[model samples]
Target: MPTREDPLVSFKFGLEIEGKLTGFFTQVSGIGSESEVIQHKVVNSETGETIMQQIPGRLTWTPVTLKRGVTSSMDIWEWRQQVVEGKIGEARTNCSIVAYAQDNTEIARWNFENAWPSKVVGPEMDAGSTNYMIEDVTIVHEGVERVS
Candidate 1:
């Protein structure tokens, strides 16, 4: 049994698109967000001293990218097509990235709200090299939270 203090392995993570495991992804990245900092200058009335202060402005969420071995499924591509056709709002869906323990027990999960595919990259072809055909999709989301 793994304790809470134990660090979860990165390779044991799972991805769920709209609450369903569509397929196994080889890589998942960009689970982060940042806020724009605004600097404010304050002047003292009595001493006439000026100081700069930093304040939080707008919050921006980084697009999450997922890479998986190419399969016969056209689900990811279909989602991207919707975006290209100006159906972005209707294409928005929730997604989850989950990390599991060695025993396959769910440990931690990050849920993303109103996510849609912003970009999709197909596998590069090479005649001399052998590699798994990988397809990647970048998902832009409005908000993300650690649900478990």
Candidate 2:
């Protein structure tokens, strides 16, 4: 069995997002202003070692299909609204990313389960708020034998 401190250990990864982008929005930065960014952060949950942190990474949404086999949830709407209105604490912006490291080398890629916006258009063409809802993030660790 692999110990927690082993050079290679298992990990679960995910992300958080907040705020919204509306119509006629122009790209000031990132993939595009309307485009959401999913950021990621990694830590050894058991050991508490900071593994990695990815910021301002892009996350795009496309039609759900059998090939994708996933659905977006409407869970984070309220929370996202609070975050955007400055009524809540700091929330991770959309699609920011981070990776994991082992023995000073990068070792894992984190991905999300859901791929659609949590918030929909509000009462009147208002850009709906979105809370960073992280789900089913995949953590692909480098196989031990592959390490040099």
Model 2 agreement with the true structure over 1-148: per-residue lDDT tens digits:
8757655442321222322311111111111122455556688889999865646665443321111112344434544565557654333323322223433343543223323333333322225745332222221111111122
Deviation (Å) of 7 in candidate 2: 20
**Local distance difference test values of all predictions, in order:** 0.88, 0.32
Q: Candidate 2 has what TM-score?
A: 0.19
Q: For model 1, how big is the CA root-mean-square deviation? A: 2.8
Residue 1 lDDT (model 1): 88
lDDT of 1 by residue, 52-136 (tens): 9899999999998989889998988988999999998878999888877778788889999999999999999888878988899
Question: CA RMSD for every model?
Answer: 2.8, 19.5
Score every model by TM-score: 0.88, 0.19
The TM-score measured for candidate 1 stands at: 0.88
lDDT of 1 at 81: 95
lDDT of model number 1: 0.88
